[model samples]
Structures are given as C-alpha cells and as structure tokens.
Target: MSARDSATVRIDASDTLRFNALMPGELQERARMRARPDFPWVARQAAITLSEAYRGNLLLTRLLNDRGRVALALLMLDMHFEQPDAPGLTTGRLKAEAVALDICSPGRVGAILAAFRLFGLVAPAPDLDGRRRRLVVTERLLAIHRERWRTILQSLALVLPEEGERGLHHIEDPAFLAAFVHALLEPMRAGWRPAFDVPAIAHFADRDGGMLIAFALFGTGPTGQPLSISQLARSFRISRSHVVGIVQNAAEAGLVRRVDEQGSRGPGVLPQPALTEALEAFVALVLVRQAVAVRRGLAAIGVA
Candidate 1:
C-alpha cells in the first residue's frame, strides 16, 4: 500500500474505535467540558502552545501527529504533568482521557503503550488482575522528555526571540510542564467551527497533508512573499511536485489565487487574502478564549 493509503487506514481504524462515543464525539467533547472545571489549566496550556506554534513557524502536521503519538505513550507511563499532589493516573484512565480529549483512540493508545514496553521506556508491573499488564515510566523516557524540552526552547527562540530564555522551565512548574505535554495538540472549541478550520493549516477543508503544506508556507513563505515550489518542498520535506499539486489544490479550493492576470507570477505560490484573514480571525479568537480560561482557572490554583 502507498504511504498515504496506509496512514489513512490507520486513521480509519481510530475512527472505528471512536464510534462508541456518546454522540459522535461525546468523549472528546465531554473531556473538554470536564476539563473546564477540573483541568482548566491543561486546556489553557494547550491553547497557548498551539497559538505560539501557529504564530511562529515551528510546527507542522507531521510534528503535531508525532506529538499526539508521544502524548499517548507518555500517558501510558502517567508522565503528563507530573503533579504529585494529584492522584495517580493509570493507563486505562489515560485511554479514556485520550478519547475524551479527541486526541486518539483506545487502540492507538494501546499500540503506543505496547511500543513503549518494547523500547524499554516502560517496564511491566503486576496488576490487580495478575494476567493484565501495567507499566511504569522509566528514566529513559524522562531523559527523552528533557531533550524534547530543549528542542522546544530552541524552536521558541527562533520565533519568540524577545522572550529570550526566561520562559524555559525545569519541568517542575505545573503550567510550564502542561505546555510541554500539549506542544502540538490543539484544543477542540465549540461554535467556532469553520469548513476549513485548524490554525495548523494556512487553509484546508480538514486537517491533512494539504494542511501541512499550507502550514509550511508560513514557516518558509510568509504572506506577500514570493514562494517557489522548490523552496516549499525543501522547507517542508515534501516533493516539489507534491508542493505544486497542493498549491493547485489550494488555489482550486479558493484558499489561494494567482497573480499577474491568473497566470504565472514567477514560480511563486501566493497566499490568498481570505486565508490570511481567516487565520488572523482564528488566532484572535483563540487568544481571547484562552485568556478567559486562564483567568478563571487561576483562582482554583490560588494564582490570582
């Protein structure tokens, strides 16, 4: 099977597991709701991280997908935010959390857990049901987390140079740690839906490679700049032809248009005004909503 086909099939398998949701996506929706009162900080952290990545050129769908897979793996080891005062989180509960967060499926979650066991990132432990398997987070994964933290800090520096190194933390701060856990994942907001939503995508009907291609434009080719297919392919790690196809698709989809009398504008892929407007509007909405979530959540944490 083709790589794209294989990936789509895997996503389809996850969709099947999600069929049991209370109402199509009840688990994810309820998780967002439950999070509001109990874990507002988590939601806000996710929003901030996503916004930062979007406004900057550091994130892509491939990186976002990898982060989701890693998040599921870490959840298996209960390495989410590392708050000792809170109760322990089990693998089973984490699977439920994944569903509730609309991040992944129980099957995908189990696959990551099993992979971690094979990689020695976790060790098997005795369970109440002796035959059942349970795993603990190992030091190796902690080390990996440290490395990932440094990488994020570096990426932040590229875009948010003004912040310098002050925002970097030792993973002990709950808010800082929470941001790491959700560096690539975006929060699912209600009523703000658009046909082509998701800030990760410069423009798209849904999240896909096309979206990733669009995202690359920001990192490599900002608005009003002349972006060549070769430049986009090299920057995004995709083929030149593929980038051309995506540009054509985006143009056909009305996310982009041509300059110079609907003809070639010197081998450049121009971003449409509508897409820029849409993204700006989306970012504004996120900052506003996340501010509210943060303000209300602060009282609970005694951080007024």
Candidate 2:
C-alpha cells in the first residue's frame, strides 16, 4: 500500500479502537440517539453546560468524549487534594477512582492517565511529601478545556438552528483561535526547518529533502512571507512539478495560501482571513482527535 493509504488504514483502525473503548456497551444506544432528529437539541444542551463550566474556568472540561470519565478524573484530583493521606491515590488512585465511578475498568485507568499526560492536560508530579507521584492540572490543560468547550458551543449553535436563544458573551476572538491553532501545529511547523530532519516524512522522501521542500513551500518564505510554488522549488532543489503538487495539496487542505494572486497564473489563492479561520477549526478538531487517540492508545497498551 502507498504511504498515504497506510496512514489512512492506521488512522481508521485507531479511530475504531477509540470509539470502541469510549463506550463499549453504549455505542449502539448512543448512535441510535444521535441519529434521532432531536439529537441536535440534546447536544446543544450538553454544549451549553460544558461551555458554562469552561467559562467558569473549571478544569473538568479538558477531557473529551466521555463526560463521566471527566467527572471521575476531576473527582480523583479533588480527592487527592482533600485526602492527601488516602492510600492508592497516586496515578493509580485516579484510575481506581475512574473505575469506582464506573467510567472504565480498573485495568483501564492507567491508560487514561497516560492519555491525559500526553496532551499536557495533566502532569505527573511528586506529592507534597515527595514520596509518591500525583497528577497536577497544567495550564495547557485549562486552555484545551476552554477551547474544546468553545468549539462544542459553536458547533452546537451551528448545528441546532433553533437552539440559539442567546449568544455567548465571552466567545473567543478570531486571533485567539488562530494562535491556538498555531500552537498545536508547532511540532509540524518546527519540523519544516532545514537543520532538523523530519523523520516522520522519511517514508515519503529522502532525509532533509522533505524538510527542504516543505520549508520552502509551506514554511514562511521571503522576508518571512509565505512562499510561492516556483520560489519554493528554487530554494529546495526540487522540480516545479513536485512543488506544485505539494502546494496544491496544502492549499486544498487549507494549510497554505498564495499571498500574491493578482499576477498569478496558478490555482486561486486562499484569503488570509479564511485561512486563519480554517486553521483554527482544524486545530480544534485535531486537539479532540489527539485527546481521544491518546486515551485509546493507552488503553490498548494496557496502561489504563
């Protein structure tokens, strides 16, 4: 299979596993409910509740997919804070709490903890006595929570036309959303530098060749401006054909856009404002996927 096909297969398998892990017994029920015509209204109510909690700076909004799991996780955190003397309240303790709360099996808690830690939603740290480790909420945790909540609210408002009784007063500004998306893309963006070889793309091209092409074409260009296809090819030692193909794909995916379009003879350019909005939405979706993937990956590895 092609590299892209392989990635697709892997992602599909991962998604299936994730869905199964999240609601093993309730999938059919959930699907049935969601298929109902009034499901959007239900989702809107849930979104409003979640958004309110997020606006209040509640830490529980960080966990996606399962509300029960989030509640259990927060309860575990609270339990740690209230009963420092409680045994089995370590990372292990949180997992046990999740199980007690019927969020997941006792054996699955470790995986859940790992998933939360991977995304910076929670951090493993030494307790006050410095003897055992405990989970502490991180700033990124709150940021992700707030972002997801906003996305949920926006999605609900968009999906449920009748549910828009009032607008959120503290909705995130476009600039904030753009910055959040940029932050999430940091790893992908940093990999485009010349000095650092992106091993992740090695399956597609030679060492540093992929980075060179990506940087010139996708990375900031002349005077820190976005580069055009022809200019990118000249800098990367690649053919215009290759550069054109890559740029086209990136443009289609809403990643890169042509800056100067008046004199252009190629595909139409993406406007700055539209690109920014698309990137923000892409980042929000990615964050949710990553959170769910981490949770599932951990469970598959028997960590949870």
Candidate 3:
C-alpha cells in the first residue's frame, strides 16, 4: 500500500504521546536546531525514520559491514548517475566516488571491493578489460538498492502530507523532494557510523541491532522515567521477545543493567555510565553532520 494510503489514519493522541516520548532529549534538541521552519515536521519525522530504518535493517545489516555497505552504494550510484556504469562496476570508479563522498579511504575501499568480489555481488568484467580488471554488477543487489530508496520515499511521503508548508512544494516536485529528503537522512545515518566493528549475532542482526542498542541505552518515558519491557514494546510496536533479547544482549555487552523494581512503573533498564558516555560520542558525530546538512539545505533554497 502507498504510504499515503497506509498512514491515512490520523495519529491517535496516545500514539503521539508515546512516539514523542520515545525521542531522546538529545535528538529533540537536534531537531529544534536543524528542522526547517518551512518544514519543521521533516526533522522529527526524519529522525524517527532513521531510527526506525536503521533498526528495521534486517538483511543488509548482516550482509554488509560499514564500509562494505558504502561500497555497494557506490556501485549502484555508478549505475544511477553515470552512463556506461551499468552492467558492471569498477574499483577505480568506486574508489573515486568513495573518496569524493568522504565515505572511506582508498585502502578501505579496496578492502570493500575485495569483499564484495569475494561474495558473489561482483564478478570479473568481460575479456575486453583484461589489464584494468573491471567488475560486473550482479542482479543480487539491484532490487535491494532500488527498494530501499522506494521505502524511504514512501516513509517521507507519509510525513510530507503532515501540517508543514515548507516541504509541501517539494512534495509536488518528486525529484526535488527526493533529493531534499535524501540530504536530510544521509548525514543522520552516516554520522551514526554503525556501532559494531564486528557484526552481532545472526538473529540479533536479523532484527534491529541499532534499535536494540538505542533502546537498551536510551529507552525511557517522556519525563525520563525508565519504561518496563512491556511498555517499551507497546510504545514502539516492537515484539516483547525482541525487547527482551535486546536488553539481554546489551547487558551481556556491559552496556546496561536491568534493575528490578527500579522505576515507579516497573523494572527499568539503566545505562552503564561508562558505556552511555561512549554512545553519546557517536550521537555527537551524527548531530554535527546533520546540522551542517540542514544548514546547507536551507541555504540552497535561500532560506535562513
């Protein structure tokens, strides 16, 4: 179903209260700073989407690493913007794009390429380029790359119809709005810079690894009250098992502790002070990039 069709229902007061409560103080602060007045709603929706999508990343999270994911994006961009980039992707071209985008270093790019090649995502190009060794693109990633953007666009659409005038015009212009939304979300994701250097357990990664971490560390009520597992699941529409596993995993990793009878409502998940500090550093990195992107976007349209 179209996002418009799916989100046609009005957001109930209870849902509004719950969702707003889910937003961390830090994220709310960033939204206040970066959200365009013309489209103040975009910042909140985008933040929610980023958290949701990053958490919703089931397959891709396990299939690719941080840099490998970038490499895959570079390959698809070749198909997207440049001509003659179809049917195949090359390390040299991927390297240039990666460097231009500041996604990774040349050495890291090489490793990414090698990893993709090792998997079946890429293959040796035809005999024509024997010396240079270009790589052919596989159908394996096409549906994934295309669908992800489609999903993002639909998510934005569900929000664009919201009570915001600034973004309304762009919504009419699909191309413009797509670019605009992309600009808004990219920094949020890239700035997050994925927490794990190594992949989590297959099942955990299959679910929402990033979401788990965020909840494990920052899941709380609007007034900073710790929420019980049932409360967290109810508010987020996440499964109880998922919440349990996430908390258990975080505890295993020493990122948080489950304190029995900790909060007025019920048992609460408390952050390990040392780990919370480290996680905040990651948030700081993303916030800086998001702020810059928001500024550039506003400036582009001659808005303050």
- Give per-model TM-scores: 0.48, 0.30, 0.41
lDDT of 1 by residue, 24-109 (tens): 44344333443344233322233334333433232233332243554455454344454544433456866787787655778867
Compare the candidates by lDDT and give the number of the best one: 3
State the number of backbone clashes in model 2: 7
**1-304, model 2: which lDDT tens digit per residue?**
2323222222345545654564354335334445657554444344334334433232332244232344444444344334346553476666655554344566657766677777676776666667677666666755564555455545444433322212122323323322333333333222221012112232222221333333223212223445555654444455677656655554454445655563554433332333333323322333233333333333433433
Clashing pairs for model 3 are 38-166
Ranking by lDDT: 3, 1, 2
**Candidate 2: Cα lDDT at 211:** 30
Q: Looking at candidate 3, what is the lDDT of residue 129?
A: 51
List ranges where model 1 is wrong by over 4 Å. 1-79, 82-172, 175-212, 215-223, 239-245, 258-267, 289-300
Better by TM-score, candidate 3 or 1:
1
Instruction: Mark the regions of model 3 whose C-alpha exceeds 4 Å error after superposition.
Output: 1-59, 64-68, 79-81, 85-88, 96-102, 161-304
Judge candidate 1 against the unseen true structure and give its global Cα lDDT, from 0 to 1: 0.45
Clashes of 1: 2
Worst 10 residues of 2 by lDDT: 190-199
**Reference-based lDDT, residue 49, model 1:** 49
Per-residue lDDT for 188 in model 3?
23
